[model samples]
Target: MIPQPTPAAPPRPARILIVDDSAVMRALLRSVVSSDSRLEVAGTASDGASALRVIDSVRPDLILLDVEMPVMDGLSTLRQIRARPTRIPVIMCSSLTQRGAQVTIEALASGASDYVAKPTGQPSREAAVQALAQDLVPKILALTALGSPSHGSARGHASAFPLSSPAAPPRTPVTANLAFSTPPQQPPSGFAPAAVLIGVSTGGPAALDLLLPGLPAAFPLPILIVQHMPELFTKHLAERLDSRCPLRVHEAAEGEPVRPGHIYIAKGDWHMEVSAHSAMPDHHSSSAPVLRLTRQAPENHCRPSVDVLFRTAAAVYSGRLLGVILTGMGHDGLAGSRILRQHGGVLLAQDEPTSAVWGMPGAVAQAGLANRILPLNAIASEILRLSARSQREAPDLRETDPREAGASGIGWVTP
Candidate 1:
């Protein structure tokens, strides 16, 4: 009989430290974390101070930190955590209220890896647990790099959410003919980008805090952004960014004119698209694009999906568009980026090292869709450089049929 080879030991589950002032909340989070075999609860802390005291001993792969806690609050603790040499990923567990959203944004800007709104208004404890699991578990798996065969059930739960597990299969294109050939490594000569569309999630608030402010108020192109978030949070995010940036930033509204020097963030729960509005003969000769918002079904398990926005922007702007995919979880922007690239649009992806989770942008980068992959800090300068190019210096590439340009029609779908 042939000797059997020794079985290799399985990888250890990622350890998590739960920190919340409420014992009940801590217990709930522990239950959620424990339900996934790929994850283990290393310890629990009542507040930020306690968490800081035990962090070294617990050696958790990630932390689920509550925004409002007794003693040292989440932000204070987060700042201290950043001061430390060892960096552990911290996921802010916040309430769905306005104050919660405000504080969560601050924590994110301060260096929290990501955030999940605590389940509220669910009819039952089980329902609440399910909601938390769907939101929190995938974040754990993504930020901790814990995707494995042992996490089967956990990954399945995550599939019900917007962020897909790493073990999941590559997403199928919405249309069969949408298959891409050799995507251009660089835009064709004379590619003059008239508009900049950005898709970001996961670590977006902080990334945006760093990015939007970098663009001077005089930045020429209109910027449309899709940041995966719920309703109230998006509003608060807009308010926060607007106060800090030189350029005007606001939550996008229906029928607003898409104008240069202003930034529009897609409203939470509403898909934002652009449409050409024929100018009144008395007012102007050419049509101008206006923002259009819809209550479309969620794509990639997300409302206000990046693909939805990208697809429409590509159609409205055609070859004159520039699509930027930033730090995010899952592949929300991949399909859109593919379609945008097909339409002679330029693409930029945030590099992995600077990303909090790298799922969305990584997909674009891996698919050969990105014309450039730059660090978080470099994206603003590149955008400025691209937007400043003379439109007349190079003839617009929009005249070429996309199919003839080596791509096919975009089949937009919500799934």
Candidate 2:
């Protein structure tokens, strides 16, 4: 009889340490991690002091840290852990509040690997649990694969990536039509959208640094963005972008109207949407469009999920909408893009060469979702061209046709 090879030995389980003040939270995490046979709950701690002691004793492969603790919070714990030169990967668990969001960003900056939003009271337990398992677990696995030695170096290198190069600011204007042959389909009622929606993550800050400043202050379109960032970091990002760009930029308020010449960022812990307002008979004052913000359950494991914003825009704006998806780590925006495409809305994605992580954009591109995939530098110019095209094609407008406008006295300006 032929000898049979013995079954391969089972792989070692990844040891994990759970740190949280709440007994319930600790139990929940333990249960989840334990459910995965590849993961083992090595130890548990209530605060930073206990966590630090456990870290030295157990030397776990991963740590799930809660941002709010009685004695020492997640941020303080992260700092302490990093200072000791231990290389264990940490995933931060945060509440879906503005303050919580800010703290999560700080944790990332300070050296925590990744974060997941702790469910707010409003969302059901099932939704909250799903968000944590889907989003946080994947991030933890990805960060751990980077290994301890390379983690610090990767962070430093990523930070140094240029926001925008000053020398190439005024290169040849790359129009959208020239880059892609197929023209955007004419809207059903010839109604052009008044605003643009953008969803970006991972390399977003750097990409925005290049794109935002190129836009003119008088550019007559409102822009709503759902960038994957911690709450506090987003405020800093807005301030930074506002200073550099000519347009007004601010975090979205609960019920603020979406208007031209302004940018609204989705606030941490709340999903932001644009809705139509009933037109008053008077028509004298500015139209009061309603902007909705909700503490609803996260979609695709993100509180201010790109999918939520994109789907809402697809429904409200329909054929008038322009949806742009940028570099990110997962397939959060794919479903929403399908909605946009079905409604005759335009879709754009960042090219893979310029992406920090190509997972998000790649999914869209591979599935034939994006109408145009352009380099990071060319995105702003494409937006300008598309907006201009929409305006020129508007049925009610008596403006000169684009072909005639190009041949005639009106000079095409790139902003």
Candidate 3:
């Protein structure tokens, strides 16, 4: 008689190390981690130092680090963790407060993989738990790839999540076949862009640190960015970037006109779009396009979504826009990139090797939406080269110089 075949054993759950100063928070985090079948808490520590002590023994697949701690803070501990030979992903658990946001941003720049805001204004424990589950769980599954069927060993885990954005929107999931169906298309030739729009998430802060500093002060087009982060965090991020960038960086303000040589970051919790300023008294002419921040429902599970910005910019700049999709967890910018392309705008995607999570940019690349898939280091030079080309090759499109428009309070002609 033939024997029945043995069934394969289920995959082991990804182990998590929780490090926070408060016992209550630790317990709450433990509950959250345990709620998922794919995740389990390996150990808990009261501070960064304590975490380091048990880290080797526990051999956690990922670490949930707290920014502020009693003995050794998250930043100091992060430096140590990064210096280690083996790489373990760390997600900073930060409060929604300004200081927490600041430190979290710094931690992200200093090698912390990602972060989640601690629930502060929740009405009840259950509500807080639900919120944590929604935000933190997805991040954990995305980072460790424990939720993915393709995930193999601990060292070579694959992502379970798709492309997406910050206070941006819930990501719209596309099957692998549909996402990569289209072959790479050639970029439109003899095209010039008047403004540059960027979408990034997950590994954005650090990626921006490398990309933004490279753009010279004389950058010809107005630059707008959507980064998945909360409110106070966006402000601090803008400040941090402003200090390092030659071009002025701002957490986009409401009603401010978009200008060349300036970088505007979508404010956290607000969807930033462009609107033509009110028409002149006669009503035939209108002023330059100004930023409009809204509380519209988040697209792709994010508020300051890349799609919103890209779609609106397409209308304002028409064929003269440049959209760049950077490293992010989900495909938040994919739909917007398509709209931009439909409007004859150019698109650039960050290549996989340089991305922390290739979800967002990868989606664009797979969809055959990107005109150029480039590494992070090369993007700046490309932008410069394209801007230079706009000046030399597209004289008709440059009917009014951005400087003259700024001085005269004029706007784009929608050419």
Best by TM-score: 3
The per-model lDDT (C-alpha) reads: 0.78, 0.67, 0.79
By TM-score rank, best first, the candidates go 3, 1, 2
- How far residue 400's Cα lies from its native spot in candidate 2, in Å, is 25
lDDT of 3: 0.79
Candidate 1 per-residue C-alpha lDDT over 1-415 given as tens digits, one digit per residue, 9 for 90 to 100: 9999999998789999999999889888988998899999999999899999998888988888999987898889888877775667789999989899988888887778789999888998788888899989988988777743222112111211112234434544222222334443865656668889999988888889889988765455788999999888899999999889877889999878787767899999999888887333453533558888899899988889999989988888888898999888888988999899889899998766567766887778778898877777888877866765632343242223222233233221211
Task: Give candidate 1's whole-model lDDT.
Answer: 0.78
Q: Cα miss at 371, model 1 (Å)? A: 0.8
Q: Kindly provide the TM-score of model 2 when superposed on the true structure, using C-alpha atoms.
A: 0.57
Clashes of 3: 19
Model 2 stretches with alpha carbons more than 4 Å out: 1-137, 143-160, 163-193, 230-233, 278-285, 390-415
- Give model 3's TM-score versus the native structure: 0.84
Report the error of model 2 at residue 322, Å: 1.3
